[model samples]
Every structure is written in C-alpha cells, then in structure tokens.
Target chain A: DVKVTQSSRYLVKRTGEKVFLECVQDMDHENMFWYRQDPGLGLRLIYFSYDVKMKEKGDIPEGYSVSREKKERFSLILESASTNQTSMYLCASSPPYLATQYFGPGTRLTVL
Target chain B: SQQGEEDPQALSIQEGENATMNCSYKTSINNLQWYRQNSGRGLVHLILIRSNEREKHSGRLRVTLDTSKKSSSLLITASRAADTASYFCATDSGDDMRFGAGTRLTVKP
Candidate 1:
C-alpha cells in the first residue's frame, strides 16, 4: 500500500504570515501535486513537481510556490497568507507513467 | 482551466438504491478515474478506465468512458450509508490528473 502524509491536518495563520505545508510519500513516486479545494470552485491545482528540482505552475499558482528538493518530499509555500488562501490543501503522488495517484490527508488552512 | 466537470452537484438516495454520476472533460485524455472522499479526509481511488477501454468495475462500483463524447459515468450499486460521500472524476492526460467539482451523495437511512 502507498502512503502519503501531510505535515498538518489543520492550521490557522494570521494575515500576511508565511505558511508552509509539507507532504511526503513513501512510494518514491516521480510526480507530486498540490491543490486547494473550495466549495464551488472544486480542487484547483496550485503547483506540481515532476522530478527533483523541477516544478510547474498550475491553473491557480499565483499565490503559491512549491519546492521539491528531494524525490520523497514536496512542500507548498505561501508568500503572504491571506483569508482568500484559506482552503483545504491536498497532496498527491503517482508513479512514473501511472495515472492512479495516492493522496495524503488534506490540511484545512484558515487564514485569519 | 478545468478538465473535468461533474453534473448534479448533489444527490440524495436511500440505502440499497443505485447512484450514478456523470463527468465531462474538455480535451482528450489518456484515462479517467473515480475517487471518493469522506468529508474532510483525503480522496481514495475507486477505479480507472483507460482511453481504449470502455468500461471497468470494482466491487459495487462501475465506470464507463465514452471517448468520442469526452465523458464518463460512475455507478455505485447497493449503496450503503458508508457510501455517502463526495464522488470526483479525474481526467489524466499523461502529465497530470485534473479533478472535477465532485458530486456529494447523501444516503438516507
């Protein structure tokens, strides 16, 4: 079984503060992604990494940045947290050429 | 730029009844997948149907894909209270998988 673990399940931060959400996968998958889930907007991709030191911007990557210094770990960074950025964040990993992705428990972020 | 969009945002059904949800995508896809998420938890993969394949099944879940129409449907048979959750359809275009808004299903006791 593949397992992906997030650094936090719930987090609260003040406005303009910096926030970091970490995700680690044990499967050594080559692909990792970060998404934010909102009520009507659905899960919008923030950023994704295909390999170590490689990153790509998704549909809604303006306020978010990601790091993939190693194969097993991916981190999402918020430059300046705002209330609008508060949403359920999810991380996922998939093996090379595989469409089936394993997800980690989401981190519900609340920016006050 | 969303890839998948699910119809009927919410559905309510009684136990033992079957539930069906539909999803439509914009561009061509390599595969389509169905996933279930319980409230605040992470998503659990249910099934995947490849581009060349038309249908696939696992346990009580059945998935069918129509490449020409760029759409797919998922059916859950004999749904129980435990099956009440948000169902999302994801489209894979080789590089990444994009998900739909999801359909929230409520099972009445």
Candidate 2:
C-alpha cells in the first residue's frame, strides 16, 4: 500500500514565526508536492519536487519554500507566517510518469 | 491559475440516490482524474480517464470525459452516507497536476 504521512494534523503559529510542515512517503515515489487548501481556493499547489534536491514553484509559492534533502521526506517552510497563510496544507507523492498522487493526512496551519 | 472548475459548488442528496458532479477545464490535458477528500483530510484518488478515452468506471463511480468540450462528469450510483465528501477534478499534461475548486457533496442517511 502507498502511504504518505504528515508531521502534524494541526498547528498554530504567530506572525513572522517560521513554520515547517513535514511529509514522508513510504512508496519510494520520485515526485512530491505541497499544496494549501482554502475554502474557495480548493487545492493550490505551493511547490513540487520531481527528484531529490530539486524543487519547483507552483501557482502560489511566494511565501513558501520547500526542501527535498532525501527521497522519502519533503519539507515545506514558511519563512514568515502570516494570518493569510492559515490554511490546510497537503502533501502528495507519486511515481514518475504514472502521475497518480497519493496524499497525506494534511496539516491544518493556523497563523495567528 | 487553476485549470479546472467544478459546477454546482455544493450538492445534497439522500442515501441510495445517485449523485453527479461536473468539471470543466481549459487548455489541453493528457488525462483527468477525480479525487475525494473527507472533512479536514487529504485527498484520495478515485478514478482517471485518459485523453483518448470517453468513459471509465470503477465499482459505483462512473467517469465520462469530453475532451472536445474540455469537460468531464463523475456519477456515483446508489450513494451512501459515507460518500459525502468534496470531489475535485484534476488535469495533468505530463508535468504537474492542476485541481479544481471542487464540489461539496453531502449524502444524507
């Protein structure tokens, strides 16, 4: 079975604080993705990595950065958390060419 | 920018009834997939229809794609209360995936 796990199910952070959301996949997939979901915005991609040590920006990546130091782990970092950044963060991983993504439980971030 | 948009932003239906949701996308796509997300949870891939295919089915879920119109529809037969969730359509053209806003479906028991 393919399993993706996130570091936290919920988190609260103050403005200007650095926040990190971690995701790990057991399927050994080469592609990993980060997205933020808002009420009307649905799932907006933040960043994605096609290979280890490689990252690409998505539609909404201005306030977010991602790291892929290892194949199984991907990390999303918010350099300065703001109230606007409070949203549900989702992580997904998939194999190359297949494009079927398996998602984690998600982290609900609350930036106060 | 979002490449897909789902119509009927929300839907409510009784158990044993069929539920249908529509999705429309812009630009060309190699494939389209349907995903379901429970409250405050991550998404689960439901089904995928390739560009050349017009329809596909899995268990109770039926997906139909119309590439000429850049639209697709997902129909769930005899839905159960457990089927209540947000349904999203995603389009991918070999690189990354783009998701729609999703349709909130509520199935009453």
Candidate 3:
C-alpha cells in the first residue's frame, strides 16, 4: 500500500506570517501535488513537482511557493499568510504515468 | 474554470440501495478517476477509466466513461453506510489532474 504523510493535521498562524506544509510519500512516486479545497470551489491546484527541483504552477499559485529538494518530500510555503488563505490543504503523490493518486490526510490551516 | 463538474450536489439513499453520480468535463482527458473522501479525511482512489475504455468495475463499484460526450458516471451497488461520503471525479489531462465539486452522498441505515 502507498502512504502519503503530511507534517501537520491542523495549523494556526497570524496574518503576514510564513507557513509551511510538508508532505512525504513512501511509494517513491515521481509526481507530487498541493491543492487547497474549498466548499463550492472544489480542489484547486496550487503547485506541483514532477521531479526534484522541478516545479509548476497550477491554476491558483498566488502567494504560494513549493520546494522539492528530494523525491520523497514536498513542501508548500506561504510567503505571507492571510485570512483568505485559511482552508484545507491536501498533498498527493502518484507514479510517473499513473492516473491514480494517493493522498495524505489534509492540513486544515487557519490564518487569523 | 474547473475541468469537471459533478451533477446532483447531494444525494440520499438507504442501505442496500444503489447510488449513482454523474460527472462532466470540458476538455479531452487521458483518463478519469473517482475518489471518495469521508468527512475530514483524505481522499481514497476508487476507480479509474481511460479515455479508450467505456466501462470499468471494481468490487461493488462501476464506472462508465463516454469520451465523445465528455462525461462519466459512477454507480455503487448495495450501498452501505460506510459509503456515505463525498465522491469526486478527477480528470487527467496529461498535465495535471483536476477535480470536480463532488457529490455528497448519504446512505442511511
């Protein structure tokens, strides 16, 4: 079975603070993704990494950056957290050509 | 715009009954997948159907895709209370996977 783990299940931060959400996968998948899910809005991609040091912006990447220094780990960074950034963040990983994705328990972020 | 949209935002059914959901996408896709998410939990991959395939089955779940119509449907047979969750359809466009708003299903005992 594939396992994807997130660093934090819940987090609270003040406005303008820098926040980091980490994800690690044990399946050695080549693709990893970060997404924020909101009611009625669905899961919108924030960023994705196809390989180490390779990153691509998704539909909504504003105020967010990602790091993939290693194959097993992917980190999402919020340059300046705002109240609007409060939402459930999910991390997923999949094989290079597979359509199935294994996801980690999401981190519910609260930016006050 | 989201690549996929699920019909019937919410559904309620009794245990032992069947539940069906539909999804429509705007663009061509390499494959379509169905995922289930319990309340406050991560998503679990349920099934996947490639563009060239029309129907696929996994246990009690059945998925059918129509490339010409750009749509897909998922059916759960003999549903159990454990099947109560949000079901999402994701589209793989060879670049990134996009998910729909999801259908919230409630299976009452």
**Model 1 per-residue lDDT at B28:** 85
Task: Encode model 2's per-residue lDDT on A1-112: one tens digit a residue.
Answer: 9999999999999999999999999999999999999998879999999999999999999989999999999999999999999999999999989868999999999999
Where model 2 places Cα greater than 4 Å from the true spot, the runs are: none
Score candidate 2 by lDDT: 0.95
User: What tens digits encode model 1's per-residue C-alpha lDDT throughout A56-79?
Assistant: 999999988999999999999999
Span of ten consecutive residues with least summed lDDT in model 3 chain A: A93-102
Tens digit of per-residue lDDT, candidate 3, span B47-109 = 989999999999999999999999999999999999999999999998778899999999999
Q: Which 10-residue window of candidate 2 chain B scores lowest in summed lDDT?
A: B92-101
DockQ of each: 0.80, 0.82, 0.82
How much does candidate 3 score in TM-score? Answer: 0.98
Provide the DockQ value for model 3: 0.82
Local lDDT at B74 for model 3: 98
Tens digit of lDDT per residue, candidate 1, span B2-87?
68999889999999999999999989899999999999999999999999999998999999999999999999999999999999
Worst 10 residues of 2 chain A by lDDT: A35-44
lDDT of each: 0.93, 0.95, 0.95
**What does the i-RMS of model 3 come to?**
0.9
